[model samples]
Target: MKLWGGRFLSKESKLMEDFNSSLSFDKKLYYEDIIGSIAHVKMLAKCNILTNEESKTIVNGLNSIMSDIKEGKLKIEGDYEDIHSFMEINLIKTVGEVGKKLHTARSRNDQVAVDMRLYSKYKALDVIDNLDIILGTIKILGNENAVIMPGYTHMQRAQVVTFKQHIMAYYSMLSRDKKRLTSAIEIMDENPLGCCALAGTTYDTDREFTTKELEFKKPVDNFMDGVSDRDYLLELLSAFSIIMMHFSRLSEELILWSTKEFNFIEISDEFSTGSSIMPQKRNPDAAELIRGKTGRVYGDLMSLLTTMKGIPLAYNKDMQEDKEPFFDAVDTVLKCIKIMNEMLGTLKIKKDNMHNAVKRGFLNATEAADYLVNKGMAFRDAHSVIGNIVITCEKKNKAIEELNLDELKSFSDLFEEDVYEFIDYENTISRGIKKEM
Candidate 1:
């Protein structure tokens, strides 16, 4: 069953076989491996490396194996070195001697390169699809919850903003994330099937035919780089890390808003969990878990970066370390995206609580400054007058809007009846900066 057995006189020790085996994790790549092999065998026949009949038999065998694997009729297991070895062994078992010809003009080096590229492309699209769902949910939230809320700076209420504007901020962040994933997919579109080991093969293999069969943009230009390039994986992991980071920020806000202290929003019971000891606890476990998993995705990215940083040109055993990290990141990000969409879609907004919260904070002090500036006070002088008014209001335990016109005029004769309109919570949002679509 071993492809390289002809060169070795003795069987590899059981311990060494166990140490070298990757069938456990890499078997997940069976579908991609079969796809690339089908294309490779067809190209082999076109190049006259295999008879047409032999190519047909091998392709049929591969297709049967793929269907069996999908249907759970066949199981991929045992001491196979990798997915490539496991597949070649199974193909030989199915098609007899003709299956040996399937690997005649290729190597595991290029085979894995093509499989990973295909897998990454599929997962990137999955990420983008989930992002579309999240974007749609955000748009719904924005349209329904356009009421005013207090926006924060340094975790303290600093200005007035509409809920729609806050949600759209995340929409903008995720829009950029979608672009990054698309760029990563574009970078991985080339075929790496015919590079064979670290150099071009002497056999007359038709790389262009296989490239077209696999739907790659083109065959890779350099044999060594084809065997060695993993920048696409790195690029994707980087993009996934950033996507998770954005999700983590949103998760933090969700956790905060769901708290009794904030009471700004209420997560649906399905997405929340009760504390074991407390009768009155409904914790935001989903949001907390998404925030926690952000670090795991970050670790996956860093693990691959460190592994690839020291490896030399062309394929190396170190590159075998690439798959687990990449797979973990993809799975983690996709799950987080889906759960976040569900959590957000079902959550309830507390518009009254948000409005009352706005009243307590001196969120209108800036508008008061603008009121003074409109009365012909210098900008810096207006700022100072507002600051002094805020201090006096705090001493009397009142908001700037609570001060009467004669009391506000003690600081400056510029105070007017229209000053109340300038600091009104609803008016502040209407007068503040607006974002262009």
Candidate 2:
């Protein structure tokens, strides 16, 4: 029988039961549900709603159920409507009539609210921990590969940069992602356990007590908002999407770097795959998959955003649609971060190839223009002189630096032996341009 089936004389069809049941996915919240219930029962006993002995019995039964589930002794199966019902049915069987009192002043509405908040809180922290690992890996790579490389804009080589600077640029982006995730965790720290359905309960319940017990910062201010709010979930999904965006950008570079045409870096065999027919094929499948998974995470955020946009105040069944998307995004981002860290940590940097590529791209053209400007040439005239010099170099099949000093002086009297220093790749990086910019 359904927990709230007291008024209905007819039984629910199997189709309705299957359609309405959330135990399939919500079983994942078994630990969270039990933790929230234990806190609530403790608060009830503190308020004199349940006798001390009755509360003890309920708490012990809940703990036993938790232990059994953790030990793989209790299988979360059968036709219970949701996790709350599954726990309640088992609690009753474990402790008899006293177990029923555990739900005296609460509803599944507030119960689910607290469970989800707890789940989000912990998962957000877990994501931050993984991000810290990624950040550390990036810092190590940045320090190790501080050699000069060509930086590009619009897929055309535009300037010279240190690989260290390039790697740390991603580090800055992930630093912001960490801050955003931490803020999301703070936003979800309120307890919703004592709010009951959509309003304050008539019982003399101590919400503050439950908040303290459950380690939430405070109880939510409004009961209706407490029951209906999914902003925390949305905020978390937004964070996840942004993090994936950063990952996708890095993955794009990794893909390009691993290609033979670029040959900037070599992915390790452990993180790469081989083609069946192509004897020389070694693919950066990990990076490619991380890039691909980014779209699915974005879709998850959009799915939840669209679901919540039209819902009314207070809890509704539509809110049930929020879980799968949030869960999938969280799982996807965590896995991506783990794999990305491994791929980055194991990859080989071809320092000579990177420096050689920088030489081929005329990345020092801007510095040549700057050199003329420093010699009292007007900035526009300096740019024009460098443009003509580049055309001449291309005609001769020579680099600007490869030109004789007399040939350079022919372009402008401002050219001097120091022009060679100005075009040096390492000197370009040492010119005080900020890495993050």
Candidate 3:
């Protein structure tokens, strides 16, 4: 029977059952759903709504069900409609009629509210730990490569830098994402259990009792807002979207670095794939997937925002749409982070290739101009002199440092013999490497 079948005269159609059922995805929250029930039963016992013996029976039944679930013995059934109903019906089967008494002072509205909050809380913690692993891997890679690389702007070499510095930039982005997850978790910590239906229940229930039992920071103050608010889900989606953007950017860099034209890095065999048709191909598939998943996380955020915008307040059925997107965003980000951390940990960096790229891009010209300006030449004149020198080098197809002193002097009298010292590839790399820090 449906949980609310007493009020409805007719059976729901198959189409309606298919549309209303959330058991497939929500079954993942089974542990949390049972935990919420245990907390609720204790509160009922305290309020005289359920006897102490009944509360003991419900808690024991919930614990046994949890054990069965962990052992893979419990199957979530479609006939139960949703996770809440499925767990409740199974509890009754295990603990007899007393299981029905567990819902004495509550409604499904608050039940789902608490379940989602608990699930989100733990998922955010998992994501934060995953980010920590990625961050630690990046820090190690950055420290190891801090002495070799050429940084670029507008897809052209702008300066010389260390691979470590490049990796640290992504580390900083991940750190900010961790902070966003932390803040979102803080906002989800409030308890929504006492707000039965859309108003405070008349059962003289001790909300504080359930709050303590569930380890919630405190009871939600407004009854209607408790069950109705999905701001926590929105906050989480927004955080996940930003994290996805970070992953996209990091993956984009990894993709570019892995290309032969750049050859700044290489993916390990375990992290890359060999083409079926090309024996020579080693593709950065993990990086590509991270880039692709960004679109999915973005879609989840936008879709949920749309679902929320047109709805009236105080708990509408439309709010049922919130869980799928929030769940999807969480799952997507977790997968991206997991793969990214592994890819980062195993990737092989080509410091020699990075050094070689500096040669092709004439990365030392700006540092040469800075050398002239520091030697008391006016900044504009120094720039003009360097600009002409670059043009001369381009025409002659030589690097700035390769030009004979006389050939450079032909462009500007500012070109002294010692100016070659400033235009050395190592000096350019020093500037690039320092800029990252």
**lDDT (10s digit) by residue, model 2, range 70-104:** 99999999979999999999999999988888888
Cα displacement (Å) at residue 345, model 1: 1.0
Model 2 stretches astray by more than 4 angstroms: 433-437
> What clash count does candidate 3 reach?
5
lDDT of 2 at 305: 93
Assess every candidate by TM-score.
0.97, 0.98, 0.94
TM-score of 2: 0.98
Query: Residue-wise lDDT of candidate 3 within 1-437, one digit each (tens)?
Result: 68888888788999999998888888888988989989888888888888899889999999999999899898776577889888889989999988888777788999999999999999999999999998999999887775556777987778766677677888888899899889888877899997888887788899898889889889898888889878888898888999988889888988998998788788888878889999999988888988998999999989889988887768888888888888889999999998888888888888778777777667777788888887788889888888887887788888888888888778667778787767776666666556744
Candidate lDDT scores, in order, read 0.91, 0.92, 0.85
Selected candidate, larger lDDT, 1 vs 2: 2
Span of 10 residues, lowest total lDDT, candidate 1: 428-437
> How does residue 315 of candidate 3 score in lDDT?
85
Per residue, candidate 1 scores C-alpha lDDT tens digits across 23-106 of: 898888999999999999888888888889999999999999999999999889876899898888888999898788888879
* Model 3 lDDT, residue 21, Cα: 88
RMSD of 2: 1.3
Candidate 1: residue pairs that collide: none
